[model samples]
Target chain A: MYEFLTGPMVWISFGIFFIGLIVRGVRYIRGLDWKLDRVTYGENISYGVRGAVRSILFWLFPYGTRSWRKNPWFTLWVFLMHFGILITPIFLLGHNILLKEKLGISLWTLPEAVADTMTVVVIVSVVFLILRRIALPEVRIITNWYDYVLLLIAVSPFLTGFLAYHRVADYYFWLMAHIISGHVLLIAVPLTKLSHFLLFFMTRAQLGMDYGIKRGGMKSKGMAW
Target chain B: MPEGTLCNKKTIDTKEQLQALLADKSGKEYYEQMNDLDVDRKALWGVIQKSLKSRTKTWLEICSHCGLCAESCFYYLANNRDPKQVPSYKIQETLGKLIARKADVDNAFMQKCMDWAYSKCTCCTRCGVYCPFGIDTGIMFSYLRGLLYGQGFVPWEMKIGSGMHRIFRAQMDITTEDWVDTCEWMAEEYEEDWPGLEIPVDKENADIIYTVNAREPKHYPEDIAEAAILFHVAGENWTVPSEGWEETSLAMFAGDWEAAKMQVESVYDAMDRLKPERMVVTECGHAYRATVIEGPYWAGLKTGKTPIDSLHYVEWVAEALRTGKLKIDPSKKIKEPVTYQDSCNYIRNGGLADVAREIMSYIAEDFREMTPNREHNFCCGGGGGLNGIGRYREQRNIGMKVKRDQILGTGAKLVIAPCHNCWDAIRDLEEVYKIGIRWSFLKPLLINMLEVPEHLKPKEE
Candidate 1:
């Protein structure tokens, strides 16, 4: 009975998610008269490759020795948590199973322990993010309806997953709820502001390389072979 | 090899001089200079109000304010950690108020919001990066400034700055004759550095047409000389248009988008007339960014085609170095601790700080880093025409405290600023705060440090 209910819920959510995303995506695509095209246009391949690699590195261990040394505490925390949990674990990894599980195909067993701990980290990080957004007067001043929606979006799956892990409801129902919510998030990724996952790394690397050259800091050592 | 000492003689020292300087210069008796541009205040304000009206709905509709923007802002972290000076707050003080009043409150309050908005922000769009919404307040502010500009209520400094821009499409009110004479002076100076290296003016069909801000000729002549030397070494064919070569657009800074658009048109006009394959913008960050990126989209409605892929001088030089067209001796830059100030227009707005650093490393031996770098770098308080308006004095200084701390924190003996406004404003802070740090353009440092080969060097007497 739980499986039946779960199955249709998944299908319904997927349908709504796909349709909503397609509407938004098509709107954005059609909206490109010229200016949008200009921004989208660039040295696409160089930017695309650079963007993918650093984004993955950035999400994992964000405060990894270098960033923490460079940034202020709050900034580092916000940077790591926002990118690490909300963005990386959920948004970038695409329900955490798409890329991570695929890439770790041989090491699938390793993810169980990592996954449970990461789920906890996501909840804690989201809590920090929520409190920081509310606590900081500057952040609060700029917060809008979308921000609240995003914050809820980031927190819900983790909470549902945690509940599922603990079997808060009948085991299958909770897992089904988690799976449905997770997939909906996957469909929403490219259409919403969540797409920064796709955009930020390229912007940062381009910025990093551009600044590096302009200030005469270092040439593109062309990355380690 | 820091070139210019931060002139210790502060411009407006006492409160009295500050008052005199800030006072309406035109109001002085017998001091009638130019005809007052009897700008229509009400109609202009209406345009501004209309612009605000359009933006308010969007402003309220966007900006999640994740505080990633704060990390991206140099101003926030610089001023003893004051969050209000964050790019968003600088935006909010004006646009936020307008949004609240226009949608929720009253028109009179909206009028007050317009005043606050016009006076406070510089419209440098560095914070657009951290904005998950990509709500470019710079665009919003620039739009508002354009509206305010149409009305005579634009801050006085921007009025003069944009007025100059209107006249010459440059920062200063220079003429064709002055530009020729200035280039001649640079050519003659470069002769000492690279003899017979002529900075061709209005030379048609040159492969590259290098455009410079009027500031290089008007205030810092050496900057022009540095460019000439670089061109000489690179062996690239480049020319400057005698009439429309200037690329710095204060109108862009001041929010006079029409005037800003006109400036872009003039550069494109120069390109059309000169028919250069490409244009290498001089070492002015905003000027370069404006000519290539923002100027096009913000004003591209007027121009039929996207202008050629104009590159920043830093990018050009780094490429030249990479291609071995231009060579440098790293030891030429003294071993003294030196830090680079990323102009917000370039780093945040243009996303070119890494290129700037790449260029600097080849010249300097010891380099110190600014705390928040690249896209996350702070504004030098001079961006967005803040320095242009004399009325914004105290606020500009307070805002500059962020940059002041960044430079001071580096404890570097020298700071390299690529943009003219950053150069002027940061130099002002060094003097005002008595931070005792010397500053110069990146090229000047390179020129001083680099060993121009005897054959490349100008022939000795």
Candidate 2:
């Protein structure tokens, strides 16, 4: 079970994620017809690039604009949650060791203490996100079964891995569960809302291009971009 | 509810009267218009398939349903934060569902979707600014509107207006004779001030061909007179086309691309014949957008080969002021505290907010800026052809409460809206809310403050 989880399953999930993203990205790029005459918010390419960069930087931080201020708790937790999820996968010691053992290449690793704390934060943030979906009426209306299922999928790997690392249950069973769930997540990223991780840049680029390039050199006002 | 005290009794009565005028249509007429279109799901799906470009696809996929865009919408903010009013929900309930179901939605669902797309959203694009990913809800809504329009689900006013433009070459069914007569009458009215002012019509090879909204002839002839006065004083070689004088494009608002193309082509054909070096559009927000920005694209003209240069009246006025051709009398400036409502098309879409404010500063003694002025300012709620659709009057009035509150907070006596639709929407708000404030078009205000030179002023007898 351990060999299958780390060998063919890992390759399968990685193949699905990387190839799926490439297909989606290529389709999106090929579909674009440059709207040379579309009216934009800015006057020139520099203005568009500036607005795009500003938008990216603003959204990268929590409470970046007044809109984000509406739900301060959600903003902070979600930001931290996303940060941990993204960073821990690449930098966690266990993941790096697996990479070194398998592929003979490994990135820098985070200390076990830091990795444990990040996994805990990710688990907590996922719980909060689920609570937010259930608690807020506006959010509740839009939430579907897929949303809850996706959240469960996102949280399982972190939860199981943390328990396994701390030896809270049978270590082999918990570790296997973690590896399988982690593969499920990798497969889900390109196929679900996790696609936002990649598509967000595309959305921001289109907006920046609109506000910056097509707008005839006018600077976007107060987050208008 | 806002914390402001209500205005005097006179203001309340005025508000009621204006609301009555807007909502005075018969129930029979509403029903008649509602049942005009037959729903064909397959045809509608085809329209959606054709309209799904990269931008729409990206916007649809990337939205995380975070509900962050809710606060950016005036409808959402003003209506006690209703989630249904959220821009994302509009996409989800209509286009999102359609995409999920492969555009196989039922007629009842399509009807509800059409109402949401047309009446619920103004397509102001303001919400996009606040979006974390800057997803343009306006573009998505427009694509939905285009789908509905292709299936013959357009509102009555838009259909009638587009029909008028297609048949008579104008909005509001103004005949060629009526247009010529109105121009002559406006020229005569302005001649009283300048004695020999020439409101030239159909003059070939003129420096500029000025076009106006049909409302200027039907309801607000004074706007035309003001433009004439400004043009006469500036000594511009401009002429109003006899054939394609009305510049407002209801077809564009209706999402009927073919009719929109025809409307634009009429102007292009006129410019082609007249050979004007430039086309100066009057102070109608949608007209300026459809003409200067979207006209060539819709009319199938090549990217860099537009027949004539299109300029908004705001740009023209600003340029005139800059070049000393039109001067503002600083002493004769408007004394009352004034605020400018940046029309969505002029500011958010056209990026002329700075030029508009600059022009306002030169004419008004005390220009009080609204809390969220310029591109970030709240829409007047009458854009996207909402003001023209009688069925959405109540929704429009309710949606405009945010703008009403913004104006009330400024404590300004007069509001200068640069676009006709903004002027109309703000006027309705002033009346509906009993705010007791007056509204004027920016052109008349500029005309009132403009200084005629000794050589141009009428000689005292």
Candidate 3:
């Protein structure tokens, strides 16, 4: 059962992830009508690209914006959540070894101890994120069963992986749970709010261009300082 | 990625549809009828389908409700950090739910949505600056207001305001004749000081076509005089169109897109009729936004640019000062402890924050900026037609506390508000909170400190 779960299920999940991503991305750009979305009219691609680069760069760091600086705790946790969720899955020694065996290709891998610590970090970040949803009144007001389920789905792999590594429960059983949850996460990325992972770049770029071409105007040469 | 009005060219002209949905009643009867109005569920869902484009769908779908946008909203801050006032939750309660459920909604729910969209938010767009994903609640509320107007669920004053635009091509009942006559009267009044000064009407192929808010003719004729004085002293060839002089659009404020289109079209028509080199609007925030930015989209202009290049009053003034056309007397520059009120439409939405600051250097000697000045400044709490709506007056006053605190922190005795809406809001803030600070528009301040050109100056008077 474990062999089947680890072998074929991984391939299926990866296939869905890649296919869903391309389809959603293509549809998004194609769906943007020049007439309805006013951004098309005044959008100078050179200026838009410049603006998008600047905005994304600024938002990538802690305390980059006044809004970010205003909420330091949220900033710290969000970065940690993203770090562990992304880094642990991609760079773990076990995952890399598995990838090498499957495809006869190997990349650099994180040290075993560091990778394990990151898995624990993902679990901690998830706890804080879940607490925020339950405790913060503004967050609570907009949150629903959908939000909780997404959070739960996102954190399960990290939690189960950590448990399996620490030998807290039956190792083989927990390892199976980790692999299944990890597969579910991969499939869920393009289907659910987790799409924010990629949509962030798209929306943030659109926002920057909207501000630059449509409103902010970027102190361009034409503007008489 | 999404559906929209684009598939059907026939659906593009939505002005008549909006006009038809506008309720005629006002005051008591207006409120009563609005209370009992039935939700057009089919049509509402139809709008929901159209609004679910790439931008709308993505914004609604991916807003993770992090609560980081809570402090970014003045409504949340001023309401003592009420979670309900958070920008994310406010948009979610109305537009988000509308999209999620495909508007399986009722009249009571629609009424609650209307209250939140109109009263709770001013469509200031400041929250967009703070949003991690740049999901502007202002944009969502604006779209929601459009839906609410279709359902006959708009506020009383907003309905009346849109009606005025329909009848008079102005927010008030001031007609073209009144606007032209007021310009003439101002020209006559200022002629004694600057000989042969004329408010040129319909002079084709000149430099600029100066347009103004309707309220300038109805309440403050001096604003007309002040603008004419600036142009006359600068020796620019300018004309004011008799038919389409009113530049403000209460229709845009009321979500009456049809009437709003008509309002801006009149201004566009004036520019087209005169064939001027450019258009220069008076110091009104939303008016500039309506005519220069959003209005073109409604009018179906493919370029998203106005018929001609348009400058905000502040931009023009800054250019005039920079080019040595209109000089400010250094001696007469204001010596008071003054601060500039950054109107959201002009500063945050219009990208004239630096231009406004440059203008301040010429006029104000001791300029103290608001704590979070320029694009990040808080709304003065009366934008988005909130000041006019009687039902939201209390909430409007409550919302002023943020601006009030910001002003107090600045320690500036005089607040220089460039936009008409911001100017009106500052005045109201003083009246309500007794902030003990005086407010003045840029025109009166500039006219007072301006050095009358040697040639235009009356001889030996």
Specify the highest-lDDT model's number: 3
Worst 10 residues of 3 chain A by lDDT: A216-225
Two-way lDDT contest, 1 vs 3, winner = 3
Q: Estimate TM-scores for all models.
A: 0.69, 0.90, 0.94
Ranking by DockQ: 3, 2, 1
Specify the poorest-scoring 10-residue window by lDDT in model 2 chain B. Answer: B3-12
Residue lDDT tens for model 1, B1-461: 11111111122123343244236563231112112223343554455454443223333343446665665554565555566656666666665664444434333443444455544456655555444344556656666565444433344455556656665666676778898898998788667557678889888888889888887788878778788877777788989888767777777766666667777778888888888888888877778767776566555442322366677777887788778777777656568898988876666555566688788767777788988666556778887767766555777787788788888888797988878888888889987899888988767666665556667764557
Per-residue error (Å), model 3, residue B37: 1.4
lDDT for position B127 in model 1 = 55
Tens digits of per-residue lDDT for model 1, A1-225: 445434565576657656665664454434333332223223334443453344334433445323333445654555645643543343322344543543443212334556566666667767776787789876776666677677667667777777877778587666777666676565555555554444344333433332232211122332110
Per model, the share of native interface contacts recovered reads 0.15, 0.39, 0.52
Q: Residue B428's C-alpha lDDT in candidate 1?
A: 93
Reference-based lDDT, residue B112, model 1: 47
For model 2 the local lDDT of residue B7 reads 11
Give residue B167's error in model 1 in angstroms.
3.5
DockQ of model 2, rounded to 2 decimals: 0.37
Give the Å shift of residue B101 in candidate 3.
3.0
